[model samples]
Target: MADMPDRTGPVDPPGPLARLLHEALTRLPADRASAGLLLAVSGGPDSLALLLAAAELRAAGRLAQVHVATVDHALRPESAAEAIEVACISNALGLSHTVLKWRRDGPLAGNLPAEARAARYALLAREARRVGAGALLTAHHLDDQTETHLLAKARGAAGAAGAALAAMRPWRDLEPGLVLVRPFLSVRKAALVEAVRGQGIAAVDDPSNRDLRFARARLRAELSCQPDQAQLLQALDDAQAQRACEDAALAERIERLTRVGHLSISPLGEFELGRSEPVDVSILSRAVTAVGGGAYPSPRGALESLVHRVRNESDGTATLGGAQVTWSKTSLHLRREYGRNGPPDLVWPAGASQACFDARFDVEAGAEPIARLVPYGRWGRGPLGHRTLPIGVNEAGAIVAAHPALRWKQGETPPALAVCSRVGWRLCADLAIEARSVLTGRPQNAANRGEPVGKGVADTYIRGQVEAACVARREVARAHFQDG
Candidate 1:
């Protein structure tokens, strides 16, 4: 906590900027909106403006609850002090604020900005969960979106050009329960600065914004002199619309495959794809991320090469992003790669009832304390039924817990302990979100004036599809476990 400033009532008016905030907040479900919101205030002009506008909305009775969090990356000498400044400002507005510090282990290697960004999100997400907030809001404005679009083109990923052009989504699932929303993507940075200044608040300016060493900073410098900002924005809007259609097409195919049993995702994070038609490379890339436990999909070139081999009917195994793909005569299997770079053996700490391992499986502990959870390969892969599923063993190396599908009758797991695959949940949840996005015709650029066609019908159809997929998933899970 920090000292509060002298102020009262609403920090600012519910003007156009505040209306933008209200519109973004409305995108969330009523239940989640009621749950509260965690704002990622970095003390910069954009975030500071966001904080002020949200405070106004809260005072105006338009917002239920709002919380503020700042990430102290500790990258610069003044980072800690800047976080305190944010806290002081938040307190003046009569809002709760938190400062999350990024703990580094040893030296950081490879892509410092990207690593810092990831760490910031992880810390913010943990804090959001602790505070019972369902949505994490960031102050990414139109200028930021433009910069992202330019950077995507600079990356030269031609194979994924369509996706790259889409830039960033307006709203996306950060994790299972938490949703990340950027309400200012349609707003301009200058308007935010003016709003903050109107409140008589001085925002913390980081020199890194103009540091030419970073590509974004350099792009920003160049764009300041460019005359065609609107043109770039229009390009981004066009690309986003195209990408939305492409995603809808992909979701449609995925639904068809799951409905017909040509594609099934086991609760143990294994993907079984029966060879009937040519498999989409995008689907394989998605599977690689889901089963391999990678934070993102594999690179397009790698995925394209793998897809080529699979299409040519190669009868062998290929590894990408710590996932192993085996092609058989009639089907293809994707599982976590064993030897190296795979999930390490983990112990279920005493007193903790639940845990997540390898970013894939969610585990629940029973009353009986287990020794360690190791890959099935270490405990004689044959008996547990599936080669990909992990098992918990006692001190004597006897299987005490395993996924319901992989349990062996010889040493059946107790009723209390359970292992559920996040991969299954993640895939189904993603499909539902995509289906809704496509059906509702939600554009990435929220400021677009285009009207959504058949929104009600689209919503109903997508909801039904989602329910059907879940039902089909349950049936497949039951059959797979029983057969195993």
Candidate 2:
């Protein structure tokens, strides 16, 4: 990759990224409440190019609004230093910026790569909310998409073309608050690298990227060396287009098969004589999720398996989805899987009546909203107490769910019961601990509730407590449900 030919243009770097970005944003999501966008800039080739291009667009009046963000994983001793450098570069470029620091030592996400990605979006979304941004953009180029497609293919993803990963997604699945715009998906890695070089810039290389044990680094290297890789990339584009068609058809079918107020029906003997089409199982699952007022949250394999199970399910039963899923004669029930005890009943601190689960929702006491917040997503109320919700398609900036909402918060701590109050005060009281827990998933005892832990401990304590709450919420997890 270091030896790849340099192809850079000051105006438009030659590749699909430019095309994708220009094409995708022609019409951003139709949110009247959308705030300025937040761009993810790593000082790396991909993101640096993104920042530069975005600034240029804004200057030329192409992009009306946007900002910049660089996340410091801080995995290495020098990570912070590198981030500071990135901040310096961004400032020189006259872009608004912020650095999200990540801890090296933490309870490992099942896959380190997956965890890191999650942490990045979580951090990015968090910052976006703070700045009143509606969406968080990324610099994932065509090459990244190609690699993603291949990886998905390697994992046997059938419905969608495996390597068409660079497709512009409306939002991140985990963080639906922000739209994840990947304008450079069409551009090659060589192009971005060259763009950075042409600018006389140096990009940071994470040591983890060099470790071949990871699939991404390996695929990247392999694709870079393959003959006629250009043609292969073209094929992926075509496949992605095909998948788009199938997904559209499936979306329509699923919409028809499903209706609000009715549980999903498992039609048996429906496939016996081919009298009726199976309706792509993948689409069916996604449709079912939509009925719940939720987007797809199942992992690739889990979702695939669930689709299969539901389609081929007999009179018997099965289970699947984000939490606990049970298949019965009645319907396929998808819910969150909890730790020890199941859901604890409603117990908002002493002040509240019925509680609101999703941060996107608001609770009004009198003429004004008692609770007006969206963590990593968006937050800001109008003068009339009307909210111009800064909404994107996925989860991005999320602060924290109310702790009293946590079944565990009901015990005896003095300040632990402050669930439905102001967001700023509760967050300051627990951020250090939460940031720590973001790295390491350590357990925090409830006996010492309301007390903050060391810098690196919040990831665990908060996550555990939150996870408990998520599951408990599942007992009553009605997706997209809101109160008047």
Candidate 3:
């Protein structure tokens, strides 16, 4: 919450700079600045301005506390000296600064700019992890995103580059929880240079920016001379719009023919389908997002390939976006595709209000059951929402549905769970939350007075096996009576 200075001060909001910066800040993941962050400061205009602004923000005490650092690629003999000068300037600004240096070479050596940039990030990530920083913020402004849009458009269709450089993302925001923000992604580089100079700041230039060997640098030069910012921004919007339109159409079709729930998919093929008629990839991705709980699974190409395989071949499945899906005539079977490892081990506090999982179940005890704790196989990737179960406690905390269960009322609060544990962690980590009830003491629906409560292998497997057999025998009896 950085407060604006007195109205007499030259700085103001609602201006282009504030407009862009405001948008970028809000778009940042979690939007919380740390005690200090590691900033990727190049001596160039974009990064230099970013650092100065970050310093001002720190002084304002609104954004996260930050320290500045520059990575000297050392491609040029002057790189180290320039980085040193930059650090000195940063120090005078009352910001702690450091310069990291690394050497690059070989076949990959020729592409050292990109390679070194990546190496520098690895160093930063390791440092952030060790130091426990919330994130590393870099400045990639509007002009950069526009330039990228042009380059990607020239190379392929609308989705060629992916979602318009999210307002921030020179660094990945997904992993390390490092929020790569480009608050200036929409700000003009000229304005940035002006911001730097407005406070009398010196800037550095990268000679490689003029190199023709790189395609982006070349397009950047060509675009730098373009005065039509409105036209360019409009074109990108249109490109994005076109992409969304196409994806939406395809996604809609997929959604209609498909059923999607959190952690499950029915008729998954429609989502990955190529354009047969009016195919929308956008809607399909939306469905994927809904089920994934914000986890990005496979990319566009992988999704398309999976859909193709399911249709062209028999008995085939493909793994995408961390889920395995198989096609069947009856329905598409989708599940959390786990390997030897899965989601990082996480702790779920009891009474958690909102919980997401593979399959969620509940139990209660009453004359007319309020909720049913059923097996995962019984429900196809969904819960019988707004329902309740019967009250009959088992050995491993599982309450059985006493009277033709699977239906519960609102009064059945303070529910318990019936989970499959012998199967291992697969069913355990999935948990309970923010759940409340009227029950104060554990009720006894036990077979014997001293019997231990909560369900165990005996109730889940052994007793379940017998119950299944009884169900089977009833079907047989009905068949015999009909034949007779």
- Which candidate ranks first by TM-score, i.e. highest? 1
> How badly does each model clash, as a count of residue pairs?
0, 43, 37
**Predictions: Cα RMSD each:** 11.1, 17.3, 21.9
Q: Each model's TM-score, in the order given?
A: 0.77, 0.57, 0.53
Q: Give the total clashing residue pairs for model 1.
A: 0
Give the worst 10-residue stretch by lDDT in candidate 1.
446-455
Q: Which candidate has the top score in lDDT?
A: 1
Residue 254, model 2, lDDT: 38
Task: Summing lDDT over every window of 10 consecutive residues in candidate 3, give the lowest-scoring window.
Answer: 431-440
Q: Write the per-residue lDDT of candidate 1 for residues 56-147, one digit (tens) a residue.
A: 77777666667899999998999999999998888878889999988786799998889999989978877776666777889997678888
RMSD of 2: 17.3
| lDDT (10s digit) by residue, model 2, range 259-344 | 33232321100001111444254543443342222333346566777656656774443334323444544455433222233222
How well does candidate 2 match the true structure in TM-score terms? 0.57
lDDT of 3 by residue, 1-484 (tens): 1222232223333344443343344332222223446677888878877776666554544444466778877777889988987887777667777777664434464565567766787566545544445457677765676777776667564555444421223223412223344455445566677766665666777788888788878888888687666666656555444444443344334434433321222221112322233323343344344333233434777666665665556556655654455654333444444433333321221222211232211122333232222232232322322111122333454443332323445675333333211111111111110110001011111111221111121223221122122224323433332212
Ranking by TM-score: 1, 2, 3
Q: Model 3, residue 191: what's the lDDT?
A: 65
lDDT of 1: 0.68
